[model samples]
Target chain A: MRVFQILTTVSYGDAVSNDCLALFELLKTSGYETYVYAENIGKQAERMGVKPYARLQKLRDDDIILYHLSTGTELNERIKALNGRKFIIYHNTTPPDVFVPYSGKLARLCSCGLDETRSLKGTFEGGFCDSDFNRQQLISYGYECPLKVRPILIPFEDYKKDPDAETLEQMGGDTKENDHKIKNVLFVGRIAPNKCQEDLISLLYAYRKMYSDPIRLILAGNPSGLEKYMAKLKVFAGELGLEDIVFTGQISFAKILAYYRSADAFVSMSEHEGFCVPLVEAMFFDVPILAYSSTAVPETLGGSGIIFDSKDPSHAARCLHEILNNKELRDLIISEQKERLKFFGYGNVSEIFMKQFKEFTGQ
Target chain B: MSTAREMLSDILLSSGAANVDVPVSFDDISVCGASSADGYLESLEREFSDRAKVIPQYRDLKEKLGGALFGFYINHSVEQQNEINARFLDVLREFKANNDEIVRLSNRLKELESRMDDNGGIR
Candidate 1:
């Protein structure tokens, strides 16, 4: 029997899209006729066999439809009408209020998304979400189906590509050996208010005050729809006299790899996430992580990295200092993070998916 | 306070950086293990952070048409958020004052301990 996954859009390098792409390839490898249909496909993804939503016709009743639920889309309404055993991969919707100030479209989309999630109560047969946090949200939304928690399938093999030469040269090859005075702390995410880039600047301000060594904050991700938020952050950083930051907006994978390779810490001040892929990425790259305990971050990290409960910049700055300056602690954290990274191991995750998938399909 | 984590906690506590009020209910949620956080590398990452730029014209025709509604509520929402932030900053101002005082007192105590250590006068 054939299987299909449908979503609003599959943008390149997005976490949800990445998971969908990996799962699509995995299903294909498993010898099932697999396809991905999205409302909009990224520029180069057409070559990868992702077809437009209009191409999704003639579905057999026995076929399976995996709908990715992360945003508001007409697909959420239309998927129920599709002829198949429909299941949803709940990526958890971002609350509308967070985006209301920046993008009314995003806000409206999220608002409609949440309402639609509730409206979709009896439509799905059985499905999975990426985190226990997401699972809980689903359960609370009154989903009665047999639900399970599956971590995102990070194609870790793809991460082994050679780091970008320019990025490596720019980072001076070995930051530790080359520059004793400067430390590189990096956060990879969009320049949205919810990601809280301003807090990174605040923490940098506090870190400089506490430590003699200066730091540069690297924020790697596209601004996407939040130009105003990014502008406000620049003004705040400037007012604080906070200089030396790199906001690499929507860079190539190789460039991102280089940042991960050269990074001392993978820091995220983001207040919301369904499953943070970068946390897994940082673990794979052996960079210690420091993240705010927001939404699914703690659940996603499990018992791996250092979790600071407060957003107080001073406390975060202190944690940064301890992780960077204390060899024993830093080493232990990295080692533990390596241990946690196995939780999202491709083999482990796929095995779990295949098991649940078998049970769900009753094959 | 003997476990590695306990020792780490002790160092942080002794230095007063562990003053963050972690709610008791949040313990089971796993916020303070070896596995959580994001850091700022003071100056080292500053150069990278300074070069932030957003690529333009990424909007498709649909997105451009939909863009008219992008920030439709920005005036009201931004104002509301600013007001809320103003209140938070007011409270934070007092919080910072107390934190600064605590830092000052902690430093003084440390200075006394150091003098005692140098003089061989502590028990």
Candidate 2:
């Protein structure tokens, strides 16, 4: 039987797109006719080979199709009409209210996506959720079918593989003048309202106010669609007199590695997230993570990282200082994270994926 | 138009007249001036916070229209349109009442000024 994975958009460095591509590769190696489809294809995905989703009409009954449900899409109606066994891989949508002021169009799409997700009650045979948090959301939306929790299929080897040497060299050269006393705090995610970069600025402001030495905050993310929000964040930073903060909008994977390697602490103050992958990546690099306990962040951490309740600037600043200043606490946090990282290892996650997938598809 | 009390106070102070000690009431100031108009609306908003609460519905609609996403930018449904129109009409009525008050105050001040001028100012 054939297998097909469909998404709204497939872009490089995107978690959902990378997961779909990895799944496609896995299914292909297991001797199944697998196809990748999306509405908008990025250059990387186009180079990797993907087809338009309109070709879904050619699939037979015994085949299985996986729909990656994240946002509103025109393909929702078509996916519901599929003759083949279908499953929705639910990657929770951000709440519409979060995007209201920043982008009404985004807010509307989120609203429509929730409506679409709720409407697909019995259309699919079962559901696969990336986190238990998302699974609970599915249940809230009235999805009562068989469901399993699985991590995004990731090729961790790619992360471990030697980063682009030239990029690392460039980044390393730039850091040479540092007295090494300046703490390099990092947060890697898209620059958007829901990601709460403003909160990060507040935390930085408070941190600088209390600390003696200068602290560097490195925000590595693509801000292509959020120009106004980014500008607002820059203005806020300027207002706070923050000269050490860097917004590395859309950088290379090699640069990502260098940032991870150089970071003293991985701090995330995002109010919304769905299985944050950067938290795990930080753990992989042995970077101690201090994240706000919200949404799937605490669950994804698996009792590993430091989970704080308040995002109030002073409280967040103290929390950050405590994590960085105490060497023992930092080591203990990293040690626990390293153990938790094994839970998301390829062998464990894939076994979970393949087993549940086989039982659902009767392969 | 300045209130009679405001004009009297200005005239007495500028002309270095003796302390008249007139009773200064809220009506001594005109609410039609640019700065006073803003103060008038703020007082209205505070007094009738529920009316102020209705402002978000229109603001939200404007946001939806301004920040409309490409695919989700369908025309508003009849119910939505009705709700928007109702909120808009409510705002219009509120502003219309304020405008009427301003006009009435201006006309009253003008008539009072003509009477005072004919009588050669206050006795």
Candidate 3:
């Protein structure tokens, strides 16, 4: 099958780009021809010997256009013009708050949620969410889209394992000599207000106050035009005398993987997400997670990681204490997470996506 | 051409205006300047007759041509807006092309003008 994967950009850190690249690799391996169209192909693709086109001209009758949402303009008109089947993969939540303004007041009054109103705006042939919870939320908001039309819970593939000894040594830490005393917590995502970096700083402060021992907190992500926010967070950390925090600005994916491997726990206090890929990546690395209970976090975590009501820092600190103190519980959760990691493997997700595409095209 | 008293009374009645004594005459309206009493009456009668003849046709034309013209203007505006946006893009493209050509043309024009000045002022 010929598939055209449309994305906004070909950046390594973007979730959509990473997922599209993984899918492209998987489809090629499985004997399917995949073409990628993006606005700007980044250096990573050039290094990997992959060329992405920017225009939509080479599509054929045998080809199917797979568009990621919010990437292109006149999407519905273009899809209608296409000779073959067209499908939209909604990576973001439906009835997006962003659309509420364009819909006008009558739509707001008539609709239950933003998703329902957006579906009424006549944008897509079919839509999909990453989880059943998101699907149900759409339905409750008056979306008439079918359950089969919803997105499959495609998990991320686990990267090759690195031994803790190798990772610790690379980071200049001797885990054996120190008796594994390092409690390294890693947060790998864009540093923005929506990612709740401020709240994460607050939780770190509470954690410091509650625990006498110093723990290493590594914030490994781009500031993403939130330099002032990052500055404020650093100043706050300084004022609180929390000197163990490290802000590694925009490292490569390999470095991120290394941090995931060496870290004792993964922490994210994001306010919202369509899906948290790093949480699954953390699971693959077998690092115990502590995340805020919001949006897709709890659904993605699913009893694998520690969930805290991030509104209360005391509660988060308490959860952290429990995870730090109880090795047996932590080990059990990590084992369960490893077992569940199979579901999000690239092969499984690729098959699921292909099956959905086939069904959408009635092939 | 009706008397001012009669015109005001008609306007008041048409507009549902209230609170005035009835039975005023053309003599009372002479103070407000009409050509004459008979001329005022004749003018009002001619006006009423002309209106009776024109109102139906005016209503029909408004219903048909007014609506059609309004729709045409709305569609025209939309098309014009799109054309404006396209023209803006075209201007940007044109500005980017052949910067040296524009400079060369200006220099040539300046040279021609200098030659013309040296000639009998109208070569």
Candidate 4:
């Protein structure tokens, strides 16, 4: 059966884009014809060899429309025109209003909700949420559709081993003692308001006060219209005398893998998300995580990382210190994370997705 | 013919064969005898001159009338223009009275269309 996936854009560095790319690969392996529809296809889409359709009229009755959460009013008119089966895979926790705050007039005109749950009601046949927390949010908002809560899992790439002594020496690490002495913390995601870079900076400042040992905080990823916020973070870090914080802007996927292997732990203070892919990647690397217990963070972590209430910076700082100091606890979390990683394998996720698609199409 | 009145008479007599009844004094002729004739000539001359001068203005009015007539003919060909124009203002008043009924019937037709299954196809 042919499946048509609709998304907002195909840009790299977006979680939805990455997830859809993984899904496309999974579906293709199962011998299904997949086509993508968007306003414009990006570099990642071109690299992945996805064909674009300008409009939804090109879809046939045998097709299944798999709409990502980014589909808005543009899909509404086309969805009303479809003669095929439709399903929405909600990837974001909140709706369009949270993304674009100045859309009140448009929301009223289109009869969509300002909140997340209310907007999704009666519009889809079945939905696949990124987590059970999102599923509960939908039910609380009175959505009576057939909902499936599935955690996003992609196939794992083999962990790249640390470099040899000679290469390590060239890279300026402790090659002679065989100790990775640099206490590197990595944050890998978009730099946005909701990502809470400011909050993470505050936690970093507090961690420095408690410990005199030098820790290098690496803020990696593109500044997504939050350059001013990032600049403010850098200024604040300087004020707190923590200028050694490294801001490596957007890097290659290979470089990212290297950074994950090199870092001691992964940290994030994002206020909202449907799922955190970096946390999953951190677990894949057996890197212990320190994250805020908000939205989908706790659900994604699943007792695999150190969680702290985000409202209090001191609490977050305390969690960071414990995870950093205690080697036994960190090792235990890493081993548990390795066992849990089996469920997120590509074959398992693809099997579940295919069963749902077949049941929806009755094929 | 030989007197002053007869001299004026001789002048008219030499020009035509009609009788020339010249007044005894030229002033008497100017004031009394020729008063009605002068008034009649002056009025005729004024009326003829005014008529001659008004010919171009009449042509301009005719051109304006022709344009208005052409515009009205073109407007009448369109189905709704006559019902909207001020010249056909009675039609506009009639349309205002019946517009609500037309809208109500249109909506009713749409509602009926939606109610019909039509093989479960969307309209």
TM score of chain A per candidate: 0.97, 0.95, 0.80, 0.85
Q: What TM-score does structure 1 among the candidates reach? A: 0.77
TM-score of each: 0.77, 0.73, 0.63, 0.65
Best prediction by TM-score: 1
Model 2 Cα lDDT, one tens digit per residue, A1-363: 889888899987789998898888888877888899887899989898787664445778998999999998767766776678999998989899876755566789899898999998788899899999999999998988998899887788888765666644544422324324567889999988788887787777777766666577889998664555665666566656775678998888888888887777899988888899999999888888888999999999988887778666666666677677766666677778899999989888888888899999989
lDDT of 2 at B117: 52
> Candidate 4 iRMS, in Å?
63.4
User: Fraction of the real A/B interface contacts present in each candidate?
Assistant: 0.04, 0.00, 0.00, 0.00
Native contacts retained by candidate 2: 0.00
| DockQ comparison, 1 vs 4, better candidate | 1
* Residue A214 error, candidate 3, Å: 2.0
Better of 1 and 2 by lDDT: 1
**What class would a CAPRI assessor give candidate 1's docking?**
incorrect
Query: How many residue pairs clash per model?
Result: 34, 2, 5, 0
Candidate 2 lDDT over residue span B12-32, tens digit each: 344321222112222223223
Docking quality category of candidate 4 according to DockQ thresholds: incorrect
Tell me which residue pairs clash in candidate 4. Answer: none
Model 3 chain B: weakest 10-residue lDDT segment is: B17-26
Q: Write the per-residue lDDT of candidate 1 for residues A64-173, one digit (tens) a residue.
A: 99999998887787777778898889999888897765567779999999989988989989978899999989888989988888999989988999989898778656
Query: For this target, which candidate reaches the highest DockQ against the unseen true structure?
Result: 1
